[model samples]
Target: RVRAYVPYGKQWYPYFMRRLAERPANVAFLLRNLLRS
Candidate 1:
């Protein structure tokens, strides 16, 4: 399953940080793909 969130305002930062903390591998995956481009 896939999920998406669109947070408005300054609070988006904390929400994104919490998500990265919870799924650390996602950070690595994102970096990998970013570098590949």
Candidate 2:
């Protein structure tokens, strides 16, 4: 699972997490900005 990978000791895990974590926020932010524009 993605959640499990985020906690384990892996080189790329944290990178994936940041990307994954920010993705939804970014999408929501974009949609709101798009509607305003």
> In lDDT terms, which candidate is top?
1
lDDT against the true structure, each candidate: 0.89, 0.68
Candidate 2 lDDT, tens digit per residue, 1-37? 3554234456577775577587788767757999998
Q: How many clashes show up in model 2?
A: 0
Compute the lDDT of residue 30 as modeled in candidate 1.
80
Task: For model 2, state the Cα shift of residue 2 in Å.
Answer: 33
Clash list (residue pairs), candidate 1 = none
Question: Which regions of candidate 2 fall more than 4 Å away from where they truly are?
Answer: 1-22
Could you tell me the TM-score of candidate 1? 0.64
Give residue 14's error in model 1 in angstroms: 1.1
lDDT of 1: 0.89
Per-residue alpha-carbon lDDT of candidate 1 for residues 1-37, written as tens digits (9 for 90 to 100): 9897788798999988888899999999989999999
| Model 2: lDDT to the true structure | 0.68
Model 2 TM-score, all chains together: 0.38
